[model samples]
Target: MDRVLLTKKGAEALQAELKNLKSVERPKVIEAIAEARSHGDLSENAEYDAAKEQQGFVEGRIKELESHLSIAEVIDPSKLNVQGKVVFGTRVTLYDIDAAKEVSYQIVGDLEADIDQGQISLSSPIGRALIGKSEGDEFTFEAPSGEKTYEVVSVSYDV
Candidate 1:
């Protein structure tokens, strides 16, 4: 599998979720299954069926999180030597030329992309265009709506 890129914060969040699932959720599901089994009639028991379904889901998620963590290449923005260019884990301020609006975005890994939270995946169109660019540089790209131009106002590695 290809190495998965993850910011330090994103990796920490995933680790926390994995810990919760393993320690708290797994034990609760096991207890629920045991309790349901005590009720008898495993074939027709609705409680048993529900517990089994929950177990399957929890186990699947655990495996998925573990696989992701195993392949994760965590990047710490503060430790990166990107100079002034936009790169993964860099927060950038941009000015839209057509709309005359200013927006801020953090270039992050695909799994951590959340536009509402001002984070854009490195593979995204705007993020791809911004990579290797420095402040005061203007670039144009094709957006879904139309062609859009943006000027890089600032770049920082700080969160």
Candidate 2:
């Protein structure tokens, strides 16, 4: 499988979910399954059916988390040495020339991209344009509404 890029925080969140599934959810599901089994009448047991479905879902999520964690390439922004140029995990400040406003974004992996939190995927159009750019560099790209231009105001590893 292709390696999945993940920021340090993203990797940590995945790990925490895996731990919770294994330590709490798994055990609770097992207990529920056992209790349902004790009710007898396996053919008509609604509790058993529901418990089994829950088990399947929980196990599936656990497997997915494990697979993602196994293939994740965790990158710590604080440890990166990108100088002032925009790179993966670097927080970039940009000036939208058309809007006359300043916006900040952090370039991160696909899994870590959360626009509401100011994290953008490296494969995104803006992120691709920002990569390797230093402060004061201006670039233009076509947006859905119209052509947009932006100036790189600053780049940093912090936040």
Candidate 3:
């Protein structure tokens, strides 16, 4: 797999999840499987089936996290000085020209992009449009709702 880009915070979160899965969830599932197996015929046991299914999910997640962490390139936004231009990990405040509203979004890696938190993937249309842009720069991109324009009001890397 290609190396995955992640913010420092994103990498820490993934690490925490991996730790929890390995230390807590994995052991719990193992214990549950053992308990279920002790209840006699495995083929007819609903508990055993459920435990096995849960074990599969837990193990799969463990593997996924491990893979991501192994190839993760953690970037610290606060450590960068991009001279006010919008770059990866920039918290950009924008004016939605068509909607006549103001909003803020942080350009982040796919692993950390949460739309609800105003974090957009660097590959997203708006994120691509905003890259290398400075304050007062206006850019347009085609959105699902049509051509959307935004003016960059501010860019901060205080993250």
Q: Which numbered prediction scores highest in lDDT against the true structure?
A: 1
List TM-score per model, in order: 0.91, 0.84, 0.95
lDDT of 2 at 79: 85
**Global lDDT of each candidate:** 0.92, 0.89, 0.90
Expressed as tens digits, the lDDT of each residue in 13-131 for candidate 1 is 98999999999999999999999999988999999999899999999999999999999999877787878889889999999999999999999998889999999999888989999
Kindly report which residue pairs in candidate 1 clash with one another. none
In order of TM-score, best first, we have: 3, 1, 2
Question: 1-159, model 2: which lDDT tens digit per residue?
Answer: 877998888888889988999999999999999999999988999999999999999999999989988888888767867677888888899999989999999999887899999999998888888888999999987666878899999988876
Cα deviation of 133 in candidate 2 (Å)? Answer: 1.4
Extract clashing residue pairs from model 2: none
Ranking by lDDT: 1, 3, 2
TM-score of 3: 0.95
lDDT of prediction 2: 0.89
